[model samples]
Target chain A: MATHGKKQDNRSPADWWLFVLGFVLFAAVGFWATPAILYAEKPQPFQFSHKLHMEQVGEGCQSCHAFREDGSYTGIPSLEKCKECHGEEPMGETPEEKVFSKDYVAKNKPIPWQVYSKQPPCVFFSHAAHVANAGLECASCHGDHGDTEKLRTYEYNRLTGYSRDIWGWSLIPLDGPPKRMKMDDCAKCHRDNGVRDACFVCHK
Target chain B: MSSSASEMRFGMVIDVDKCTGCGACSVACMSENNVGVLPDETDKIRSITWLRVYQIDNGQPYPNTQIAFFPRPCQHCAGSQGHHTPCVSVCPATATDRDPKTGIVSQIPTRCIGCRYCVAACPYHARYFNWYDVPWPEGMDKPLSPFVAPRMRGVVEKCTFCFHRYQRAQNKAFTSGEAMGEMDYQTACTEACPSGAITFGDLNNPEHKVHELKKSPYAFRLLERLHTDTAVYYVSAREWVRRQADNYLSGEKLAKVQAGGGH
Candidate 1:
């Protein structure tokens, strides 16, 4: 009985590393597979640089993502907006601009840009309230996308069809807007700011 | 439960005598709110309507009979003490709430779990449960207003007093850096009333018409004794019409009371 107990103790201590190995392996697999399995990526219509456009436009982000006279944000710039700056000729010598000129600009077709921050149909986000009324910076909610040279790959949930930005890029639910934009994040901000967090305020 | 001084109490006061029971208000309410139309809407048990007009008649002999129409919408109850609105309190999912800022009862169908508790708790029968997913006919979905989200089956919906219009008006006000005028926000039914029987505005604002109209001696709310503290009011000179608004004991009678007096 004494020999058996001693043997069991020795085996248990040695096998503790195996349990640690299994846990690490499983956690790593989970961290890798979760995003890959749940999300599907779609490319934007063509490459366009906000950095390049930002240099030429007088009004920062409003020059392209303009608000209508009624205060509604015109989310994506229409083809007519692009026509204001670029005519039949390609603005830049890049192949992307060549494709934009031939396929979209010259054809007068609207670019089917994949929106990264497009919310669910149920959410009624008023840019006028956030931007005009509260005077919130665009970068406050939407990271530094305007400063990026190239558009990032748009990833959306396979089940809900919502952009990954809505749930956020982090697998660990530890961050708020600019990293994640879930309902709780919004409520938290509203609560902190002494804003009315009524359901109808955000939801239609 | 009284609102703070700065809070706006959006309400409506309808002159029942001027209402011809034409149902234009009901029609306008449905289109404005995107209330579904069923193939067999004649089946009142299953049909949904945001604004329902009840036909009431004076119980008089052949030569004296007179009828009046009561266009009923969600009362936007402030409850007995102010915050205990029957439907809002009974909602287990917190799908419905009375907005303290606007005093408008807001129902979020997406958050509703189809419990039907709110539908049963409402004394005014203002809430309706959607039984089926509304199948918009070919080309019918195109004209749907982008402001209001279409509710799916298994949720309760009711009148919002055209809150989306208020949201739009607020957006315009935000842009113009000006306060929202009385005419800036009006419900579709109020605008559609041919006889101008329905007057909608912030009842607390003295500058608006409804603030004064609701104070008339003829004004009364439905089930006032129950103390729902509803935002909607009705005015009728006829004794029978005011009597029909609430239940009374055999010898009991409705006393002449100033509207907005409960607040």
Candidate 2:
């Protein structure tokens, strides 16, 4: 019994140091390095200032993001819509406009805008209900993405490879707008508005 | 054909006599729901079709034999009274559900854990498991219906009766200040049926066509003796077709007349 106890407790001070060091290293890697590796920043197709366009157009978000008579949301304006104003030449003298005209508009190619607010394949979010029926402003869930001067580098989760909008911006999600786009966020909003529904209500 | 109430039980009544064995309904359903078919889909069991046409025949020799096409969609079984649908009750993840209000069985692919318990529990063989990610051909994704999100691999999917169409109809009615009726909301399969074999409407509403059709003497459900209480009904004039609906005892008499006399 004594020999067994001795063998069991035979870890030295150096061994103890190594064990503690290994544990700390594992913890640090798990808490920080792993998350750092998992998230990546991707560039958008072109930077179009929503604030500038909103101010110039004076028609609100609907001018760009149209809602059809059938209550279907036409997401991300087509190049034809862009050509309405930028028909002859590029609208503005900015690099973005030059790229839009020379690379896309002049060539008659559609801008492949990387959708930031794109949910997962399973979620079914109806823009008509949130926009027309519920009367929510563009700033509600999207935060101030529309007002920014430049588009933020889209952060993607390497595991799911989904836009951060699906999981949220922070490593540790907190309570607030734009913190996360998980089901809980939707449920919270629905609960606040006294909307109770089954799981299939938003998921499909 | 008024605005649908919570008590509304939307169901389908397909006239087996009218179906011409054409696969229009299945094709339409696949495209409408973005149900992708694999390249090597020769294995009918592995292939996923929200609405599949099964060719069943009367087990007889030569000239006496006749085959009929049975278009099988998810029955959206009401089950006994209202709850305990075979698929719904056996689902470990609760991915599939029978909506208490509309009686439409809804399958949420996102919530599905791919356990496939619902697939096994379903007697109709309506549920299909996605063996691979949606194999959309080049540029085919562009034309995919924006309303229905394409499902990923490792999930189970089944018919939702085009519930999104109902949602759109409701939205249109709300916008136009009108009441959405049965005519405004129809499944893609129902609309695409060339023979008009499939009829869909609120079964609870007496004014609806399905309410009248389901009460026909010829109308019978598949495996009704087990009492799945499936919402989908089939009507046929043939006695053999009705006999083929469910199993019977060795000497059990199903109908008053024997099998060979139908015209």
Q: What interface-residue Cα RMSD does candidate 2 give after superposition?
A: 3.0
Off by over 4 Å in 1: A1-24, B1-5, B256-263
Candidate 2 is graded, for docking, as: acceptable
lDDT of candidate 1 over A114-161, digit per residue (tens): 888888877888888889898999999987989999998899999988
The model with the greatest TM-score is 1
Please give, for residues B192-217, the per-residue lDDT of candidate 2 as tens digits. Answer: 99999999998887888998888877
Top lDDT hit: 1
- Candidate 2 off by > 4 Å: A1-29, A90-93, A171-173, B1-4, B58-66, B81-83, B131-146, B250-263
Give per-residue lDDT, candidate 2, residue A71.
Answer: 65
lDDT for each candidate structure: 0.87, 0.82
